[model samples]
Target: MRELGAHAAALAARRPGEVRLRRVGTSRQGAPLLLLSVGHGSRQALVVAGPHANEPVGGATALRLAERALADPRLTEGADATWNLLLCLDPDGSRRNETWLTGPYTLGRYFRHFFRPGFLEQPEWLPEGAAGAVLPETRALLDLQDELRPFLQCSLHGVDVGGAFVELTRDLPGLAQRVAHSAARLGIPRELGPFDTLYWPALGPAVYRVPPPDTGDLAAAITEAAVESTWFHPRPHGTVTAIVEAPMWGVDAVEDPTRPADPDALLRPVGHTLRRDTERLAGILARVRPRLRDTPGAGRLLAPVDDYLLVGPGIADSWDPDAHVPGARALPLLDTARLTALRLAGRRLALRTAGLLHQLVTASGRDPDGVLPELDRLIDAWCADYRVGCGAYWIPVARQVEYQARVVLAAFDLAGRPTRPHPPADRPARHATPRPEPVRRD
Candidate 1:
């Protein structure tokens, strides 16, 4: 963590005018991830950060943006000057994943082992108290937002599977068009709508409540309340809020399956798209920058609600495995099937192979001492098979499998027993019972 801070400080020193670093707060390990502020002080500013642990690109990009902002005089000189940038919100998670960043493993293998989700185990959504109640990182950010009262705030993130870029916003002016144009410029396919098609069935799609659109006192009240309690409740200010998502490693276009498979290939385009969008963002701020300077109170505030409403009764009705595209069904099922198979195989090899050796020794009754050598061989062979067949297959099936394993393991310990079913029911019952034979239509 100190290494990261030193690196950031070095970058800031290289370009002093546009870049400046301040210690926002410490992590669980007491490591500080500095916030890099670019541009001059303005009533309206843009805030962005990355690396939320599992997805490190956001942090990397935030650092890159800080570097570029420092180098470019135009960004900070004129009316378009001054925005607060929060770089690397979760340095703890970032440091946790340092092995993958500096390790010798392939990217696929690294993703499989190092991906860490949010507070609740979801990939992108931050948990209710992630890090702790009023995490220093979150606290510093809210303080800055309140003090600076920036007109726009964006949380940058990336997805591992989907190939499309999405901007999550309740109601922001020209947001959809801006995101779409930026994606097109960067050559990334995009979707501008609800946040529904983001999860798989096994993981369960959770509905998020967005604040109603309004303005003034109510908005300020909601924002203040949120900061005071760290609980999300909708407000009616209609302040411009947006979240940008770039697919980390997947197909280039959601509509086209023939695009490049390498994740690095997508980085340049994603960066370019973000760069273009940032420039447009600059334009938007420039237009409204003077107003904020002239009349700070005139600006509106927007707050995001933090509760996920589980659509329990409507799960089947609203569920669409292929909601994002036509005829593109079964991908999630296929991935889940592969994950379930690998998990079962690994567990079976571990337990069954051990039992087989024990049974052989007991039945022979010719002395259990002689069975030790054969047991070692059996264990080695079983492990080799498990690695090749299960671990290997799990690498490409999205990072969620690893997350699910962690969750299941934790549940097991909490319950004082292995929560995962032993031997995994011999391949998930082969076709899900045929949906009750269609209720005998005749």
Candidate 2:
């Protein structure tokens, strides 16, 4: 973010006529979250990147978009909309991953530094605190949305492995095609990722339609702070929210939408691993609980991950194997890319859990028996395993960044285009809104 901040400021200086940089909000750690306004227009479009600290690929793209927006205002979906950019939403988390950002962006380095906010701590999770004491970063985004009610908003996100994909608040006409085209132009193939399509069904190839988030303060019984599904809830009707997920590594399997022939072969081991991870994580939590019970912000760091590792499996198991996937195709699942990515995800989760434990024990200042040393060994082992098993396909960083930017333009097109749920009865209807009149050319 320091670099991006410098760049954004520099862009404003260089393009004084087009760029205007301002501090939109402050992070939990007091880092300024910046907003770069690039065009002088009536319609508003908001774009944010780096919502998840671990997913920093979008950060680079956001910077590129900021620069491009200045040179060509139409990139902001034309001069009609005043394009706004939030360079980094999760500066706190993003700073945690910078250790690998500079170089050695190897699979090992990534998992070693991999850290995502526990579910409750995620930016999308709302009611951050008792009242206005909410997370300043999240508050900034919410306030921006309320003020702008943007015709289109996109949060740039990239994945660890598998092909690229997208998520939108609604199923818009030609939007999926545009997403496919933009990604295709970059030589990147569409992928639903390993388990993404399983969880979030697709509206079209490689375009997973995010179900509209409920309009309620998410306070599940699990924790008073937030719930698992407290996603970025779109505030205004007809406002479009989109997310494009590029990946570090990808393969053709992601797009096939095929059912694995030996379902048991892939299902059993992955299932076992999930359950084992859950049990293993629970054990660690139990052992560490008594010691770090009162550690500052422990609940914020602990509860969400604990629930994620433990509860997610039950959700998967409850689904009958006999039932067809909501969007699953009968095509033969021939590639091992998805399977490899799935396993890697578990390993990453384990590494992240171990890392938190190390933090917890050391911060507790009560491990006279050198549990921290033991944790060091455990974390080291996980790292070694992750490194050894890091055999997933890697997408070029440039490719990842470019796809992220192009998808935003596609999202704008979707927002402007007419939409209605049909052809696919499962989708809800989206009435077409009048496209904003493009600013007159000089």
Candidate 3:
């Protein structure tokens, strides 16, 4: 986070005539949320990075975009949009992930330091449930959206490893293909299936457009998931919202477009395992939640894992290979390796469950009792075991950064297509192509 701040500060200093640097708001930790406005244009586009701290790739890419725009405005030269760059919306969380950002990039290492906010607590999912109550960071982003009312906006996002893909408000003609080609050039696979229950309305290869999740209905159930996407709220006028997701690890399964050798049999064992595990977690929760009631911040800490355990079982039942839509069929085969990775994710939720329980007990002003020692020992074992086998599937930092940058540039090009008052290409004439500008090379 310090390094990112330094780079932005230096760039703003170097090109005062072109860059205007200012704090949009302060973070939970009192860190200033910085915004860099580059170029002077009538239409404005907001590029946000570091909304999720673990996804640091976007932060670097955002900086690169700012630098590229400064060096040669062609990146945005023909877009007729001024750029508003939010350096890092969640510095508090970004700082938490910084420990793993520079080191050995391994799955275990990443998860060990992984610190995503409770989904409900994310910067993107905000200002809805609490009657516009928000973190300072979220307030700043909301403020920027209101002020600029940008014609286009993108939140840079990355993933553990799979392939490159995108999330858009709707299918833009030629944009999905353009994004797919870019990822293909880098040997990154386009995620072919419903990546999760979250996204829907798949546009084309590697593109998805999910409607805003129900804030009120979900809040009553999960109590942890974010209630709204900032982009969807206040319903901007024809403003295109987009996001890029790249994997840190390079997986051959993602690179290939083949189904599992035995599609029918592939997911069964994993489903069985996760189901059994889910049951075990549920049983444990029954025993633990009673002891944890009224503990300090324990409810907030438990909200996510509790929701995961409660909701995870039904998730497997929804996985019907035959029911896959066209783009969904393209998803990487959920083989043993991928299933194992999913298991690790479950382990993470479990670890979170135990760790939070430990905190609850330790801080309860209660005496160190029989169960507390037992919890401590179990947590230690999980941590140690994680270090040994967690980072098997890994990608180098340089490759991850390179692929992300390429995708970001491609996205900018696709989004920068001439905007008409009505976005006519969503119709049958999309193939005729929208006017495009000269592509910028990094």
lDDT of 3 at 40: 85
Which digits, one per residue and each the tens of the lDDT, describe model 2 over residues 340-374? 54555565556667666666666687876566676
TM-scores across all candidates?
0.48, 0.78, 0.75
- By descending lDDT, how would the candidates be arranged? 2, 3, 1
lDDT of 1 by residue, 114-216 (tens): 4343233221222343334345656655555555554455555554333333332333322233333333434333321112332311111111123332332
Q: List the residue pairs that clash in candidate 3.
A: 108-390, 192-330, 192-331, 193-328, 193-331
Pick by TM-score: which candidate is best? 2
lDDT of 1 at 58: 56
How far residue 429's Cα lies from its native spot in candidate 1, in Å, is 49
Q: Assess each prediction's global lDDT (C-alpha) against the native.
A: 0.38, 0.65, 0.63
**Shift in Å, residue 189, candidate 2:** 4.4
lDDT value, residue 365 of candidate 2: 75
Q: Which residue pairs does candidate 2 place in steric collision?
A: 249-393
